[model samples]
Each structure stands twice: as structure tokens, then as C-alpha cells.
Target: AQTVTQSQPEMSVQEAETVTLSCTYDTSENNYYLFWYKQPPSRQMILVIRQEAYKQQNATENRFSVNFQKAAKSFSLKISDSQLGDTAMYFCAFMKTFMESSGDKLTFGTGTRLAVRP
Candidate 1:
């Protein structure tokens, strides 16, 4: 089993700026990986990024990026040029490598509530 932790329960960032949310995880297995998810007021959880354990390079998507330190078991998300629409509850999640049909066991962190201020 894997466990993810988000240290900050709440964070605020100004619009058009940058913000990074910190996350840490514990796992005994080596093949499992990490993911960042964003849930807005609409109550939909969106996949922000994915990082495989063996990958040396961090995963990135548009304005979102991750600082993945496999040695330290840390994965943090960096949001560049933040926007009002980015205000949401961000979660750090973990999943073991499994067949897509078998179903994924995702362990989610408590989540960090982020607010994008104007």
C-alpha cells in the first residue's frame, strides 16, 4: 500500500503568479507512481499530471509541472501563471501498476485547498 501526504491544508496565490504545492509519499513497492489531481467547486476531479517512478524527467502539462524527487519520495506541483479558474482543492495521489481492466487502487492525500486571488 502507498500513502500520500499534502503538508499544506490551505494556500493562497495571486492571479497571474506562480504557486507550488508540496507533497510526500511512502511506499514499499517500486513500480507504483504518483499523480496530481484538481477538484473545483463543480466537484469534478481532474487529472493534472502523472509521474512514473522510473522516469527521470518530471511530468508537465501546460501551466502545470511537478518537481519529482524519487529519492526523497517527494512530488510537488508547480502552477505557473496562475488564474482564477485554478482555484480548487488539489490532491496528491498514488497508484500501483496494474492492468487497466483490473482496476486501479488510488490512494489520495487529504488535499490542499488552494485559492487564486485577484
Candidate 2:
């Protein structure tokens, strides 16, 4: 099993600014995928960005981007042009490329609470 860690528990950012959340993981698996998920006040989960272990390119979705360092097992989420609506709990998750008997399951970090202030 892999374990993800988010060092910062809480952070506040001004609207229209930028913020970065740090994440690191310990894993022995070779083929895997890393992801960042956002959960707002309503509890709806959203996929921020995804990075593949085999791919060297970082993944970005809109204002959300990830800085993935495979060798260091580090994956950080960077929000550009942050908005008030971006306030939420951000989780760093990991998944293996292949499915296991129990099905593909995601191992998640404790999470970082992001509050965007107007």
C-alpha cells in the first residue's frame, strides 16, 4: 500500500492570486498514477489534475496544475488565478495502473484545507 502525505494542514489565499499545496508519497510500485482531488463545502468531489508515472509531462486542467516529481515521489497542486470558489479540501491520491482483486482503489492523503478569501 502507498501512503500520501500533505504537510500543510490549512492555507488561505486571496482571490485572484495563486497558491500551491504540497504532497509526497511512498510507494514501491513502478506503474502508477497520481491525482489531486478537490472537495468543496457541499462535499462534491472534483478532479483537479492527474499525472501518469510513465509520462514525464505534468497534467493541468484550467487553472489547476500539478508539479510531479516521480523520482522524489512528490506531487504538488498549484492553483493559478485562485478564486473564492476554489476554497475546499484538496486531497492527493494515488492509484496503480492495474486493478487488483478488490478493484482499483485510491490511496489518499490526509488533505490540505484551502480557503480563498475575497
Candidate 3:
């Protein structure tokens, strides 16, 4: 069984500042993909970043990056130069690497509601 945990229920960051959201997970599978998804008021969840368990380098996007500590089973998101558009509920998710006949499903954390203020 695999599980994702987000300790903080809510977080706040000022515009132009940076914020790091914490996430932890438990999984026995060696090959997997970790992701951070953001859901705004519209309820559409958007992919923020993704990290592969076997990859040593962390994944990053324009303003989003992940600090993946595979040994510790930790994957956290760092948002740089936060903006109001970044305000959303962020979820941590995990999915095992696809196999021909595998029935793996995504396991998600409770989520952290982030507010970017002016």
C-alpha cells in the first residue's frame, strides 16, 4: 500500500516571494512517478511538476520545482515568485510506473490550500 501525506492544511505566500510546500509518502515500489497538482476555485486540477523515483535530479517547470528525496520518501514543491494565479489547492500524488498488465492507480495526499497575497 502507498500513501501520501501533506502536513500543512493551508499556506500563505506574498506575491513575488517563494514558498515551499511539504509532502511525504510511503511506497515500496522502486519505480514510480510523483506529482504535484493544483486545483483552483474552478475545480480543474492542473499538473504542476513531476519527479521520477529513479531519477537523481529533481524536476522543475517555469516557476515550480520539486525537491525529491527518494531515500526519505519525501517530495515537496517549491514555488518561486508567487503570484495570485498560484493560489490554489495543491495535491501530492503518486503513480507506479506502468506495466503491461498492472492495475496501478494514483494515490493522492489531502492537499495544501495555498493563498498568494498581494
Candidate maximizing TM-score: 3
Q: Tens digit of lDDT per residue, candidate 3, span 5-105? A: 99999999999999999999998899999999999999999988889888999999999999999989999999999999999999999999978987678
Each candidate structure's TM-score, on Cα atoms with residue i matched to residue i, is 0.95, 0.94, 0.96
For model 2, state the Cα shift of residue 110 in Å: 0.6
Assess the local accuracy of residue 100 in candidate 2 as a C-alpha lDDT between 0 and 100.
59
Which lDDT value does model 1 have at 69? Answer: 94
**Model 3 has how many clashing residue pairs?**
0
For residues 1-118, what per-residue lDDT tens digits would candidate 2 score against the true structure? 7899999999999999999999999999998999899999899999888898999989888998989899999999999999988999999999988665656789999999999999
Worst 10 residues of 1 by lDDT: 96-105
Instruction: Give the per-residue lDDT of model 1 (tens digit) for 1-118.
Output: 6788999999999999999999999998787779999999999999999999988999999999999998899999999999999999999999987676896879999999999999
lDDT of each candidate versus the true structure: 0.94, 0.92, 0.95
Best by the lDDT measure = 3
Worst 10 residues of 2 by lDDT: 96-105
Error of 3 at 37 (Å): 0.4
Candidate 2: give the clashing pairs.
none
